[model samples]
Target: MEGCRNSKDYMMDVAGRVFVLGVGIDNVNLGEALKRIQEYVENGTAGLVVTANPEIVMLARKSPDFKAYLDNALMVTADGIGILIGARLLGRPIKQRVTGIDLTTALFEQAAAKKYKFYFVGAKPGVAEAAAENIRKAYPGIEIIGIQHGYFNDDSKIIDDIKIKKPDILLAALGMGKQEKWIEERVKPAGVPVSIGVGGSFDVFSGEAKRAPKWIQDAGIEWLYRLIRQPSRFWRMLQLPKFLGAIILSRLFSGK
Candidate 1:
C-alpha cells in the first residue's frame, strides 16, 4: 500500500474550491480537471477523485466517515445540477459540471493516446467487460489492464490485485457511497493513481442504458431525463428539494 500521505501538489493550482453541504468541490473546468488527473498519473501520485452530486452529497452528510473520506480526495468535481445550484445560491459559481462519464471518457482519450493502462471495477458480471470492449472500439489503443465485477464479499483480494497491476487509473462503478468508499479504503492504498467512482457508467458504456441527448445535458437537466427514463428513480429524485433546502440552511447559518 502506498498510503495516503503522498504529496498533493497536483491540486495546488486548481481553479478554486467551494464548500457546499460541507464538501469542498473544485470549481475547475473539465479540461483543467483532466489535466490534474493526468499529472497524478504521470507522477505516480496515489489519490482518489470524487464526482459529487446531490445523492452523494446527502450520503456524505449522513455518514461522517464518508464526509471525511471525501475531504481527502485529490479532487471532487461538481457532477450534479444540485451542486451547481447550491454553489450559485451560496454566491460561489462553479465553472461547469464534470460528470463521471465525461471524466472517464476524457481519461480514456488520454490513455489511448499515451498508452496508459487502466483497470475497471464494479458493474454486473459482464458489464465491465462489455464497457471495456466499447472503450476499445472507441479508443483503439487504450490499454485496459484489469477488470472485476462488484459482487465480491471482501475487497482485500481486489485491492491486492490492483496493487500488483498498478494501473494508471481505476474506475469503480459501485454506485455512489460504495464506490467512493471502495476507492478511498481499497484502491487508493493499492497505489492506483487517479482512482474515480463512476456510478453506473459501465451500464451506459455497455449499452445497458442510454444517455440523454447532448442538448438535454447542455441544458443541465439530465437528471430530469433520467427520472423520465427510470421512473423508479422518482423516490430518489425527491432528494433534489432536500438538497436545495440544505443549501438554503447552509447559506443562512454560514451567512455566506
Candidate 2:
C-alpha cells in the first residue's frame, strides 16, 4: 500500500475500506485484493501491503511513525479475528478475515501462473531457504530469485542484493515491526514493486509449523489454538483487551 490515496473512490466499489486508529484497512475479498496487487506489480508501483492484526494495531498506537508508515502502505487487510470484531463493533463490517499466510500462499499460486519474480527474506538460519524450496516444489514455475535469512546485521547488503535481483515482489518474514520497517526503509528504496510483512508464514510453509484445521480457522479461534500450542504468547494476548477498548472508545466518540 502506497499511503492513503485519492484513488480510494475507485477502489471502494470493489472492496470498501475502513480506517481504524488512523490506519486504513481494505475490506475486499481475496480475489479483489489480488487483482489490486497484480495492478501494482504490472504498473511498477512501489509500495508495501500490511496484513494488520490487533497486535500490529496496538504497536502502531505506541509509534506514531509506524502508524503513519501503515497508513501509507499500498493496502492494509484485516488479518486478525480481533480486527473483524472491531469493525463490526464500529458498525462497518469487513467481508472476511484474510490471514497473512493465506495471502502469501495465494500470491505464490499466482506467481506460478504469472511468472512473477519473487524474493524471500527473514526467518531464522535456513528457514527462508527451506520455505523457498518448499514453494518451488509446490508451485512449478514460481521464480523465487533470491533467499536471505533474518540474522544479517547489515540491511544495506540485503537491499543491495535485492536490487540486483530486481524481484517483482518481496516477502519479509522478520516478525511484525521489524518486517514492516524493513520494507518501508529498505525494500521500497531498493525498488521492489510489491513487498509485504509475512510474519511466521515461512515457518508454516517450510513445514516447521502447522496451521490450525479448517474448522478452527473458520471458527476464528486460531488464536486460541496458537495459545494452546505456544502458551508463551499469553503476554501478547493481554493487548487484545486494550485493542477492543480503543475500538469501543473510538465508536463512542467518532460514531463510526
lDDT per residue for candidate 2 within 1-256, as digits (tens), equals 2212222212233336776655578887788788889999999999899999999988987898888789789989999999889877766678888888888889888887877999999899998899899999999989999899999888788888898889999999998898888899878988888999999999998999999999999999999999999999999998888888877766555533
Per-residue CA lDDT of model 1 for 130-155, tens digit only, reads: 99999999998899999899889987
State, as a TM-score between 0 and 1, how close model 1 is to the true structure: 0.91
TM-scores of all candidate predictions against the true structure: 0.91, 0.92
Query: Can you give the lDDT of residue 179 in candidate 1?
Result: 84
The parts of candidate 2 lying over 4 Å away from their true place are: 1-15
RMSD, candidate 2, Å: 4.5
The reply for model 1, stretches above 4 Å from the true place, is: 1-15
